[model samples]
Target chain A: MSIFEIIGAVFLLIGSIFLFLGGLGIFRMPDVYNRLQAGTKATTLGGMSLILGVGFLMVETNWAWMVKAIIIVIFIAFSNPISSHALARAMYKRKRYPIITSKDENMDAYREVNENEKKEEDA
Target chain B: MRKFLVILILAVLGFYLFEAFSGLGLGFPRFEHGVKDYYLDKTVSELHVANTVTSIVVSFRGFDTLGEVTVLFLAVSALGSVLYKRRHDVGSRSILFASSGIVRSGSKLLFPAIILLGVYIFIHGHLTPGGGFQGGAIIATGFLLMLLAYENFRVSHHVLSYVESLAGIIFVVIGLLGFIDGGTFLQNFLPSGILNELFSGGVIGIIYVMVGFKVAAELTGLIYSVLHEKD
Candidate 1:
């Protein structure tokens, strides 16, 4: 293996490690929010890196592998976080809370809008 | 007593599963002689389909696929009937648009790309690992994202019905054409060109494309019914 292939193998190792940590994070995280955060973030990065490594390894034989890998990486980047975000929103709507939250959490603006809408409906 | 009975049941199931799977090797798919060899040999030679699974699904077992598509269509139709009653209730759909701007924008941006990818998968089904079912599901998911994130997002019932009916008719019509052209039902009557090309699998590719559209419409309609039932 040449320099690029060595780098690709290293990336593969890192990707696998991250993927393992992602699974561990899912198992160990305290609440839905924390689990979603850990699961989506780590898995997305891990999967992207792993696919990128495969692309690099196959670059010598066929350049198309890299293109496909990049497309997959982009897809994972776009989809993983969005899906987790949707899941977390659904959980929140269902009244599943995080372990703790400050009184003025960043999402209070959204809550305010929703509360106002409810008030309007009531009126 | 309950726990013991559950464990006993589980043990019996495990034993049966073990007995059933004992003949096959651990991981690798070994399609040896007999029927397996015949399909493998015939698919490449007569049909010129690169993916044997595609040939089997879209040609050899095309009738099974027709049945599967019919079942899906019936399920969607049933859902539409059940949900149709409450559709006019017109209660405010507050469950949607609860997401922030980031999610809404991201989903919107990804929708077209997701659809393009799904179309690509079904079109290339004969040559690739994925096929109509997987691709159609992916397309439905794209619509699902839009449906969940936006209040105004609506796939018209009329359009969905038209597409679904047309696709289903086309699939059956293709199968029927096989009788006229070839001796058997759903036979590869059309000339299968060189293998691995886009159009090499002849009617297999065409049928898969139709199945993709049919499934996409049905699943999208089903999701719409479940999501937008107002009462």
Candidate 2:
């Protein structure tokens, strides 16, 4: 095969690997937020690489078709993360999952603020 | 426990009964003799749209495009109504604009480029895989970038609504005109010029332009709603 074909093949392989990792992350992740980040980010990158590979593999006559395919890839790459972020934030607000751990120093301060607000409201 | 079991049984039975009674034929799309072949052959060349699917959607199925735009409009409205924040509420965290150099400069560079690209796609939609929907979404992204990179940015609601409504009304009027002049609702009433050139298709480019505007407006409205939810 030609060098172009080899390069395309490499991209396709790498994309598939990332896609597999995304699925693994989805299945193994403990919580909704982490799963979403893992799944969306990996799949978006995987999808782009796969499409780019396919575009590269096309011949001259099909160049326009390949370009069109790449445009779609670009569209998905931009939109997916934003949508996922929105959904995750909504879930977090709804308290859909347990917080596994907290290493931050401001946790107690946040709690104190909430307590003060409650006390003031009761007064 | 017994009541729960009975409810589950009834639900399962109801689903089964509905599926069995449903009259939908389990089959793929059927073609009438050479009709599909003829249209497929003529579409790309005649419409100057590289993607036959896009041509079919925006031109032949123009009414569907109208419905899609309306759906998006309704979605924006619904999101707005649901997510509207009370004046007293402290709202979502205010986005700080004093980020590092990379985000500030990167957005400044990327925003204009994205807008130009959106316009380019919309204008050349007839000759490309990109169409009204893609271009509209791209335009929305440009607006979104501005909103993110600059906290003070606010889209002009009056101007956006005026443009959006005008485009939608024009689309409907064109469709109505098609029915008045011809048999089909969105029939190509205008002249169909020679293939593979700008301004060649009859009513196709007009429809695409309308769709592009409508989609851009509605999506931008949706993004605005999302951002201003905590306002």
Candidate 3:
């Protein structure tokens, strides 16, 4: 109806698209770690966009709802990455190695560390 | 033969469910003039509360809330008892695995803000959509984040238990006070302040605050016990 509403609708559409992409990534990704990265990043942005769109729509009527929306956006931004990181770390600790297609420097370093520990044990 | 029999049973059940559901309207529910009207009309004038849901939860259905809180308490206690272990039994297994500096710092930074948001939600329950349960869950989530990020973080058992007991006691004492004042249980004895204001809703707000504290403490304790399980 209004310009703000139109903008809100656009944001909502973009957010929905991102969310769908996130789901697709989860389905397509090879390993647990990759899937977590895709899902977390895409969904967090998607969700925040949706909330912002709703806040825009409510700007004309109620400002309080917009404030609440902002708070939610901040919360999601803060929490999502932390959760994904925890999951990734836990998986790594449990020896759930990723399927490596090419040379990965981090994996090489991790292997070297393990070898060093084994050598120390042998001594 | 087994597959055929299973398919026949599934078809029969699906048909029955479909037929039953098809009789009911699928769209928006029809508006009715029952207790809904009474609550909408009387909530403001009688209770001086803008939120009818709060009035209903804290006043009309106070006993139900109490029962729900009791069930939650019982569930938490049961979980704690089942997961209980002696100090030595909780072996010094390093719960904190090696984590990146980003995660460690991020959790510490966000923890206080999340707790503040939870407190805000519960305190404004009478005026807002969120109340004790929602706020408590959010607070518990913050604790969960800390547990996941920090290796040696522990929620003090004594503090949680004390807060839980104190909140429960205050809630009951308030209800008893109303009864003793020759009114119904959990009746609003104090003068209902101006509507739409924070201090309004009298006993309803107070009761909700107590519920919030109890829920937050109980949930945090439950999470702690579960996370600290002996390997």
lDDT of each: 0.87, 0.76, 0.86
- Candidate 1 ranges with C-alpha deviation above 4 Å: A89-123, B1-10, B13-17, B23-33, B82-97
Candidate 1 vs candidate 3: the lDDT winner is 1
Docking class of 2: incorrect
Better of 1 and 2 by DockQ: 1
lDDT of each residue in B1-231, candidate 2, tens digit only: 999999999999999988986755557565567567766877855555555766778776666877888898788778877776667875667643233334445567667768888887877677777878889899999888778766778899888889789988988888888889997787778887666666767787787878888889989988876676554
Each candidate: RMSD? 3.2, 7.1, 3.4
Q: Candidate 3 on A1-123: residue-level lDDT in tens?
A: 988889888989988999999999999998997899789999999999999999989888988888988999998988788878878866866778777777767754565665686599799
Q: What DockQ does candidate 3 have relative to the true complex?
A: 0.62
True contacts kept of each: 0.54, 0.00, 0.54
lDDT of 2 at A75: 71
- Candidate 2 stretches with Cα past 4 Å from truth are A18-52, A59-123, B1-61, B67-101, B124-130, B173-189
| Tens digits of lDDT, candidate 1, B89-188 | 5686455545667778999889999999899999999999999998999999999989877867879999999999999999988888887888778876
Candidate 3: tens digits of C-alpha lDDT, residues B66-176: 999999999999997777777766776655565667898999989899899899888888898888887888898889888877768888899999999999999999999
TM-score of 1: 0.87
- Write down the C-alpha DockQ for each prediction: 0.64, 0.12, 0.62
**Candidate number with the higher lDDT (1 or 2):** 1
